[model samples]
Target: MFREANSTLVDREWRIAEVCQRLEHDLEVLGVTAIEDRLQDGVPETIYTLRKAGINFWMLTGDKQNTAIQIALSCNFISPEPKGQLLLIDGKTEEEVGRSLERVLLTMRTTASEPKDVAFVIDGWALEIALKHYWKAFTELAILSRTAICCRVTPSQKAQLVQILKSCDYRTLAIGDGGNDVRMIQQADIGVGISGREGLQAARAADYSIGRFRFLRRLILVHGRYSYNRTAFLSQYSFYKSLLICFIQIFFSFISGVSGTSLFNSVSLMAYNVFYTSIPVLVSVLDKDLSEETVMQHPQILFYCQAGRLLNPSTFAGWFGRSLFHAVVVFVISIHAYAFEKSEMEEVGMVALSGCIWLQAFVVTLETNSFTILQHLAIWGNLIAFYVINWIVCAIPSSGMYTIMFRLCGQPSYWLTILLMVAAGMGPILAIKYFRYTYRPSKINTLQQAERLGGPISVSREYRATTTTDRERSCSIINHSTEEQKPSLRTSSFRFS
Candidate 1:
C-alpha cells in the first residue's frame, strides 16, 4: 500500500478492489462460483474510466502484488510496461492522508499570486484543504504523510476534502454509482450519481444521475464548465430587489398614513404585499429553482459569497428599478385618485401593479436557481405568513373590542379587495413558471435506505449504522428519478456564468 490520490471513497475502494481481486481471482481459479460473481459485480466504473484515459492506476490487494497487477491487466485497464507510474496501494488498512493539517497549512504561505484564502485538492483524493499561501508547509507535510486506506474514513474527512478543494479555487465535481460515494457526492461542486444496488443517497445527492456511470462522462465534459456564479448572483439580487420593492411600498404607505389619505392608488399596501411580495417569490422559486439537494450539499460560505455578488451593477440596478417603480406608480395613482375621486378604481390599479411587480420578480431570479433552495423556502414562508397575518388582521368581524382594532368592515368592497389581492399575489410567479418540482408520497425514502445500508447516522459519534435489529426495513420507491427528470429542468434558467 502506498498513497491515496485524495478522496476517501477512492481510498476505501483501492483496498476493496485489492481484496476482491486477490481473494476472488484465486477462488475463481479454484472454481468458486459465488466469489467470482461477487468480484464481477463489485467492479466500479472509475477504474475503467481512468484506464481509458491512460492514467496510472494500481491497488495493493492483500493478494500478491503481482496478482493485483494481474487482475488490473485482465480488465485491460493496466499498462503492459512495469513503469514507475504503477505503484501498489495497500488497501486492507485505513491510513491518514496527512500527519497534521496545521503542519500542512504552514507549508502553504499566502502570497499575492497564490492567495491563502484559496484551498486546493491535492492529488484529487485526500480530504485536506491546503492553503495556497502555505504551499511550502503543505509540501513539508506531504514529506511526512502516511499512505491512505490504513481501511476506513470518517464522513467529516470527506467534507474537509471538499472544503479544501474550494479553497484552492477549483471546481471539483464528484461522481459515484454506489452508496460509498454519498458523502463525497454531497460535497462536490456537482455530483453525478449513478443508480445502483448501493442505494438512493448517491442519486438523491447528485446534480444528475443515470442508470449507468458512463452517462456521467457527458455531464462532466459538458455542463460541468457552465458557470453558476451568475445564477447565484441573480438569485440574491432578486431577493434584495423584492425587499427593495417592499421598502418603497412601505415609505409611500407611511406617507399616506401621515396625510390621512392614500399616496398611491396604483396598488394598495395589501395588494403590493400579495403581488409584489408573495407572487414574485413563489414564481421566482419555481421558475428559478434548483434541487434542494444541491443547496444542502454546498458549504454555507458559498451562499454568502453568492449573496455578495448581488452587490454588482446589474443586480443593484434591477433591485433599485423595481422598488422605484413601485414608489412612482403608487404616488402617481394616489394623486390621480385624489383629484378624480377614483378610489373606486383602486381595484384596477392594484391589478396592474400586481401584474408588473410579480412578473419582474419572477424574471429576476430567472438567472439564478430560484435564488438557491433554502432561500426559496424562506421567501415563500415569509410571503405566505404575510398573507395569513394580513387576513387575520383584516378579515375577522368580531363583536368585541378585540375586533375593533384588527377587523375591517364587512363590506362587499373589502371582500372583493381580498379576492383581488389573492389574484394579484399569485399572478406573476405563475406567469414565468408553468412547471415546477413536486414531491409525492410515492417516492422512495433515501434517509431510510441510508440507515438500512449500515451507513452511520452520526459519523462523528461512532459506527452505529448496522449495530442492531433496529436497522430500518427495506422498501421500494413508488416513483421518482433525477431532478432533471422532473418537469423543471430549468424554468427561468438564469446564470452569471
Candidate 2:
C-alpha cells in the first residue's frame, strides 16, 4: 500500500514517480483508454456457484499499482461490485528496463538487417544495467501489509510474504510461469506452473498441474468439499461390510468340520473375498477430503467408543438377533444331517454360498455412498487380484491349515455350522457402526468474499467495463512510457493454486 510520504530519495525517486504518473495521465487525455473489464462475468449462476462452493481468489501482479487495483475491482476479485477497494501496493519498475533497452537498441539501430548485430547491442546494454543500479530501484518498495491491498514488492519481499502467510498456517499455493517466480513457487504449499514454456522447475514442485485458472474453481470450490463427504461415507460402509463377511465365512467353516458337510469350496472362498469383501472399501477411499465442517459421519460409529452411559438396549439386541438367527439355522441343519443319511455335496451349494456373499457385499455398498456398484473400480480390481492368489493358495492339496483358516471344502452338514454363527453375529454390528454416515449441514456460508483489494475485483483488461467515473478510472493508471524504469530486485507475479 503506497502513501505519498515525505521524500527520502535524493529527490529523484519522487520525480520519477511523478513523471510516470504524468505519462499515464497524458495517455488517457490522448484518448488511449486503459483496458479494464469484469474478469469474473457477473452472471448470477457464477455468483451462486461460487458462494455455494466456497473458495476465494486473489490477483497479484507486477503491473502498475493503479492498474492492478483497477483490474481487481473490475473482476470483483476483491469484493462485490460498486464498492470501492483499497490500493495496497504498486510495483511497475520492470517496465523501465524495457524502455531503457528500447532507447539503447534505437541508438544502435542503423537498419542492421542482421539480427545477430541487433541482439549483440541489446545484450550489452542489458548487462551494463544489471551491473549497476539494481539496489537503487529496490529500496523504494514499501510494505504496507496491515490495510494495504497491494505492495510494491521485490523478490526478497515476495519470499518474505510467503513466510508470513506460512506462519499463519494457511495452505498457501503459488503458481507462476517465469524464472523470477520460482522462489515463491518453491516456498508455497502447492505450486502450479503455468506457461511451462518458460520453465519446469516450478511445475515439478507443484502438487497438481493444470493448464489454466478456470479449471482451478472445480478443485478448490466444489470437489474439495465433495471429496470430504465421499470419504467419510466410504469409510463407514467398507468397514461394516468387512465385519459381516467375516462372520459368514466363519459359519460355513464349522458346518463343514462339525456336521460333516462342506462349507465353501476353495473357489467359493476366493470368489467371496474377491467379489464381495473388498470392493466397497476401495471405492469409498478413492475420493478423499479433509474439510472440517461438512464432514459425513455415522451416528452409530460416532458414539460407539464413548461409554456404557450412552449404550442403548437396541444396540446390543442388534447383535443378539443376528447371532440367534445363525445359531438356529446351524442347529436345525446339523441335527437333520446327523439324524439322517449324509448325501453327496452338490456344486449348487458352493455357487449359492458365493452368490450370497456377493449379494451381501452389494447391499452393504448401497448404505453410505451415492456410487453405483460398478464405480467401485479399485475395490473390484483388487478383489480380482486377491481372488486369483487365494485360489492358487487354497488349491494346494496338503495345506490343511490354510483350508481351516479360510473355510475350504468339507462335508456339507448343519452340525458344522458354528463358523456361520460367528459370521452372522458380526455383520450387523459392523454395519451400524461403520456403514452409514450421518450427513452434516455444510458450513459454506462462512466463506468470505476474497481478495486483498477489499472491493472491486482486480485484473488486467477486465476492469474497463466496471469503471464509470473519472476517479475509479484514475485509480487505474495506463502507462504511456515517460521515464525508463528497471525492476531493481526482479520479482515475479505468480498464480497460487
Candidate 3:
C-alpha cells in the first residue's frame, strides 16, 4: 500500500483491497487484545435522573451498532427490562433503509395497545437515506420511540441532528467530551463539555464544562433551574426598580414646570446602581431556594423549565403594575406630606429621592425569602452605604453640587418625611401580602378535593379532554411553594374554586 501510494497513487478501492489482502494471511493473532472503557461512576444514576427529569438522551457515536448498544445498556440509557425492544436499521441501499424505517414506524403506531418500550438504532448510511428520502417518517419514529441512538455518525451528522431538533423549537442541550463533538455542541442551545480522556476541544467550545458526566444532573436540575429563575426575577426586578425611579422623576417634572433637571443628586443617582441596588441582585443570583434533596426527590420540577412557569409576560406585567403603584404612592405621599412650601424644590427633591431609594430597597427586601448571613449583610450594607453616602455628600463644601442641591439633609422633618414615605409606600404591598397569605386556600383541603373527584383533575374542558393518565404522570412534578402532596403542574384553569 505504501509502495502503491508513492508510485501509482492508487485509488481508494485499490488501497482498501490491498490493505485487507495483507491483513488476511500475514497477521497472526499472538494474543487477543482487549480494551475496556468503563462507564464513569454515577453515570447510570445521572441517566436515571435525567430520564425522570423528562430529558431524552441520545447516543451519537462512531462505534459499531453492537458496541453502542452495549454502552447504552451499561449506562442505563436503555432499560434492562426484557420488554424493551431495540430496532436496528441499516442497509446497503436506500430502498432497504426505507422499508426498515417503515416497519419501525408501524411498530410504534401499533405498540400503544401492547405497551412495549422501543428504542431505535440507526447507522450513518441509513440515517442519510432516512433524512433524504423518508424524513417525515424518520422524524415520527424518533419522536415516538422511548430512546434513539445513532451509530457510525460523522461529526456533521451529529450537528445536523442537533440543528434539526433546534429547528423544531426544542431547547436542545448537547454534551460531549471530544474533538469530534465540537460542531454538535456549538449547534445546541446550551453546550456542556465533559472533561475526560477524549480531549479539551469540546470543553473549549462549550458553554459549561464539567469533570464528570454525573455533574450534568446537578448542572441541569439545580444550577440550570435556579439560574433561570433568578435571572427571570432579576430581570423583572431590575426593570421594576428603574421604572419606579423614572416614574417618580416624571411625577416631579409636572411640579418643576417641565424642567429637565434630575430630582435626585448625582451622588445619589450613582449610589443607586453602584451601592444601593447592586447587592440584592447579586445575592439573588446566588440564592438556592430549593434543597438538593428536595429537587432530587421530585424530578418533575424539571418539567417547569419547559413550561416557562417562572417568568413570562404576565409576571412582567405584574411587576410593572406593582412598580407603578409604588411609584404613585411614594410620589403622592412624599409631595403631600413634605412639600408644604412651593419654593422649596430642593426639599421636595430630597424627600422624593430619599423616598425612592428607601422604597426600592424595601421592595428588594420583600422579594427575598430566606436570607443567609452574607445576604443579610448585603441587604443591610446597601442601606448603610446609602446613609453614609447621603451624609458625606451633604457635608461637602458649599461650592460642591451636592451641597448646593441637597440642603434638607440636617432637618429632622426631612428624616420624618422619609419615614412616612416608607410607611405609605409599603402599606398597600404589606396589606396585599398579608391578605394573600391569610386567605390562601389550604393545600390539604385542595388535596382532599382532588381525591374526592378522582385522580388529578382539571376543570378546563380542553385540558380534561386532552389529558391522559400517562401525560399526567409526565407533567406532574413538585410544586416549589405549596406543601400539597400532588404535583404542582400548571393547568389552564384555576384548580380551586
lDDT of 3 by residue, 222-280 (tens): 88878877888899998988898888889878987888887776666766777778777
Candidates' C-alpha lDDT: 0.38, 0.39, 0.68
- Give a tens-digit lDDT track for model 1, residues 1-497: 32342234655777767756655653435354332211222233533432232112212122333433444444433444543123222211123433444533443432213312222223223323232234545444322221111112234444444444445443445555445456766766666666655567777877877654334333432232123344444455556545544554565557456554443243245455554455444444334222333322222212222223334556566556545554444334433433254433333333334334443444443444435565565455544554455455434445112232123333454344444434443454445333332232111123223334656332122112222132211100000111112222211000000
Candidate with best TM-score: 3
Candidate 3 — worst ten consecutive residues by lDDT sum? 475-484
Which is the winner by lDDT between candidate 2 and candidate 3? 3
Instruction: Mark the regions of model 2 whose C-alpha exceeds 4 Å error after superposition.
Output: 1-52, 80-148, 196-205, 222-280, 283-394, 402-494
Which is the better candidate, 1 or 2, if ranked by lDDT? 2
TM-score for candidate 2:
0.44
Model 1 misplacement above 4 A: 1-136, 139-160, 167-172, 178-183, 186-192, 197-209, 217-241, 244-247, 250-317, 333-497
User: TM-scores for all candidates?
Assistant: 0.37, 0.44, 0.78
lDDT of 2: 0.39
lDDT of 2 by residue, 7-69 (tens): 445676777677667656644354564433223123223323332222223333445545555
Top candidate when judged by lDDT against the true structure:
3
| CA RMSD of each candidate after superposition | 18.2, 18.8, 10.2
Angstrom error at residue 181, model 3: 1.3
